[model samples]
Target: MDLELRHLKVVTAIAEAGSLTRAAIGLGLAQPALSAQLKRMERALGGELFVRGPRGVRPTELGELVLERARVLVPAVAELQEEARRFGRKRAAGQGQPARYRLGGTHGPLLGGLVDRLASACPGASVTTYTSWSTRELAGLLAEGRIDFVLTGVCGRSRPPSGGGGAALVWREVAVDPVFVMLPEGHVCAAREEVPLAELADACWTNVPGDGCFAQCFAAACARAGFTPEAVYETDTASCVHLVQVGRAVGLCRATFPPTPGLVTRALRGSPLMWRHVLGWHPDSPAARTAEAILAHTRAVHTRAAELSPSYARWRRGHRAAL
Candidate 1:
């Protein structure tokens, strides 16, 4: 029997969880079923993938090599399956069904406005939004055709890498989003309208876990300002906001985010950190036409958002010609 994506998944899961029992639970299979599958996979490959131990299990040298390749293969296969399912659903819905646009991105004011505008512009069409903290992840989905387009942040100082699948994708910048320091309402620096990057050298920071474009931009900016931020906590948007609100740590946010009750956002002095919201899509996909229509509305939505954000507005004024 030939090994398949599922077999590769089993191999990687076993390697990662370090135990067949745990891997079975993660893969939602009974231990015996997983064990049987693993035996078949090992037989097909002519090797033992795991060295069973009293404690758990560890990958053999061959297993480690297989797991490395499986890591990349499994996700690509999964994405292919997901895209097929999505397309099948749309097709089964009939020819009269409205055109569907799947947009994915990080949560931000621009994304919110863009979704609203797209929905308004194409009243009969189905507009779906997917949220991911990582721009590169969103870009990958776009390139895989699982998502029609991506609205994501790209650092001014560092270009966000196109995912492995995004080689043929096109990126269009929609708006500039300046970074802001978010602190507890009563924090010592909260009262200040602008905070210098050096002042927060000793502060604990919260950030999403990823070496994505935004993280690199933040690190580069800190390095230029003569201090590397101590990122003590890694969490998602809601948790990151909560960390700042409860005075546990400071966090960075875009200028366009609406103010939270317990938090105040102060502009970063010297404008060391800034990013642009970009729309990315594969040029050959049907969604490319949808993207053209969306881009027009996106520019208008960003313009309105910039008007509401003083820092973004100031930056926009100077960069008006380029924009």
Candidate 2:
């Protein structure tokens, strides 16, 4: 089509101003040029766009419909143009990958493995991993296209969209690692098959900032165990594994724990507690291929973690006597 945005701009201005003279003045175009552009557009669209009256030019019904579409089309085209320019600049830089990816999660044994696995698998792809304290920050990045994918716990149950007009991002469950109580080798609770909540009823538990979902779950579990927790020290970072390894605190729970060089995991007997991990990416993203590759890598790690649990069970036997 010989159609151009200049035609739409002229028509829209005329419809809004309700006069060709005012529209032409606003657009800095001669009255005849603006009128000619409108005629060209009407001819191309196979309909009359304007009706001239004694007072002014008014949009026809067809013109109203075209104007409505132009409202959306104009900004969408502008954004596409900006994106194309960015892509050109990135290409010129000779960036390592065809697409950029941002992935984030709080540090943990599971996430550590995931980062290594993803980077190794997509060696040519650029992957940025952020250890953030805010879920909203992560969500905002996804919405703004600052990040391609995010791996974290669903902070809590949230309400769905009211109108459901927009596309929902894709989310997949990654792992459900139980919140384990981490303690040093000879703690009394570690000797038991499962650490009883009552056993630590009065124990001073070290608390980390509840910025991530796992930390929130940990706080709730402690409350269910019937105690407002007392923290020996509070750090914005979840360095509980460090505190546990040195026996600074009696115990701490996390979604993923590094295999303590000397520390051990005491499963609390009952409903085996765990935090849900989710992988997410925008459905409309251009990074779909990168997101798919990252998701596949994470799933494989989760599967391998499942297969390796037998080793954990075997290791638990040696720690049983201490419990």
Candidate 3:
């Protein structure tokens, strides 16, 4: 309960986002969980940090004092950590140690491919991975030099993480993939090769939660189609697959989502949504030295995935949106 660096981050995130729910999304926590954590934080500090209102929360006098100090400490600690990492890298090279690769990202196909490629290219090297749903969390880790690289995706035209260590990183596009809808093979929509967004207006939906703008983008697209989704169940990828397999809901999937039994993925009409796969790393880090080769490996994985998905391969032949 002692005020820690993580607590400072929570306070800062809520203040910047202006609402508990938005802050929770950005922090990769459920609103209820974030609220509970705030209560604990308040109890430990002996005061409430925010005054909640219908519009959003605002800082009290005490909250302002805490925030002012937190802003200074957070970035200063980040810089110190980066300096330490740089020194460590130099020492490792001086000792003739094997190369080390530390990667972070949410669940996806590209991460695995990149790992395999790096291992093959650098024999006897050390490659490790860390996975999380929060974009800010990953960015924070990268900025602190805890990880060497990140592989993630964004919605059509939406940008990558802009705050929480994201600003210090350089991002490069790995590939652009069309978003696909996954449904039970026997479902009525499965009859069509390309289903309209409006066609599933009444259907319940399920998706894996992540700290990306994808959920918001999906809502916006649904609005354009003249209907709101009846319900959106946020859970893990396996659960999403199970929900779709049981005919309980449709799923938003990447076009490269490998085929599963009883599930068939199809394109949406007009290509209303797309996923932009991107890779990021600190420009000053060792990862930068091999960024070119890493990027090529990732691009090759995307191309291979497309070839494996027959439906995607056939549809892509007639459209260039995914490229």
What ranking of all candidate models by TM-score puts the best one first?
3, 1, 2
Where does the lowest 10-residue lDDT sum fall in candidate 1? 157-166
Best by lDDT: 3
Per-residue alpha-carbon lDDT of model 1 for 31-117, expressed as tens digits? 876898899988998899999999999989889889989988877876775587567546645554346878887877777888788
TM-scores for every candidate against the unseen true structure: 0.68, 0.59, 0.83
Alpha-carbon error at 195 in model 1, in Å? 1.5
lDDT of each: 0.76, 0.62, 0.85
Instruction: Give the lDDT ranking, best first.
Output: 3, 1, 2
Residue 322 lDDT (model 3): 40
lDDT of 2 by residue, 1-323 (tens): 58765456567778888998998766544577678767778889999998999999877899989899888876686576448546744663565446456776654455667877867876776767777655544554554455667776643342211111132667777755555666678787776656766567666666454333445555676678787666645554346656766777755554244455657766665523555667777665566546667777887876666445543454345455532
TM-score of 3: 0.83
RMSD of every prediction: 9.3, 17.3, 4.0
What are the per-residue Cα lDDT tens digits for candidate 3 across 1-323?
Answer: 77877689999999999999999988766688789889999999889999999999999998999999999998898788868877866975677544788889888777887888788988888999999987767877777778878888888877776436545688899888789999999999897889999999999999988766788889999999999999999999999999999999999998988878989999999888899988888777766777777788888888888888877887889786445
Q: Which residue segments of model 3 deviate by more than 4 Å?
A: 1-6, 12-47, 52-76, 92-98, 163-167
